[model samples]
Target: MNEETIKNIEDEKFRRLTGVKRSPFEKMLDILREAARLKKAKGGGKNTLILEDRLLRALEYIREYPYLFPYKSKRWGQ
Candidate 1:
């Protein structure tokens, strides 16, 4: 396949995983780069399971309720 076909496939895969159908741009590229960096960091000389557990805990908290921002700021932050 040509480069354009390969990119279309990759973009489709990324969209399926992220649920965001966006055209390829620098921001998306940066995000993919960050993902690779984190993956490599977790894989190299790190306790991967514990890192993943911590990530899951953070995810659970955010999923159950919005986090971080103080209650007062929610009304005014916008």
Candidate 2:
């Protein structure tokens, strides 16, 4: 399908979801959890190491700049 059609489909799918959006911290937590799962599931590898590094950087970024996640608090009018 064309780009517009694809975008509309994705928008529709997103609108149909029933829950509030995840905060940046929550998202980072999920990433860390996934990284931990991957670490436990297999032996060490270059790809796994790279992914873990990326996840760590993401967590650090959110920690260092919490304002980046305004959606984290409903009181902020998010």
lDDT of each residue in 1-78, candidate 1, tens digit only: 223433556667735533444444335546656886888877856444433234334444554565554664777875
Number of clashes recorded per candidate: 0, 0
lDDT of 2 by residue, 1-78 (tens): 222332344444523331222244346557777877888688664453444345445555666777867766766876
Ten contiguous residues with the weakest lDDT in model 2: 14-23
In candidate 2, the residue pairs with backbone N, CA or C atoms under 3 Å apart (3 or more residues apart, or in different chains) clash, namely none
Q: lDDT value for candidate 1?
A: 0.50
TM-score of candidate 2 versus the correct structure, residues matched by position: 0.30
Q: List the residue pairs that clash in candidate 1.
A: none
* Residue 40 accuracy (lDDT) in model 2: 68
Q: Positional deviation of 38 in candidate 1, in angstroms?
A: 13
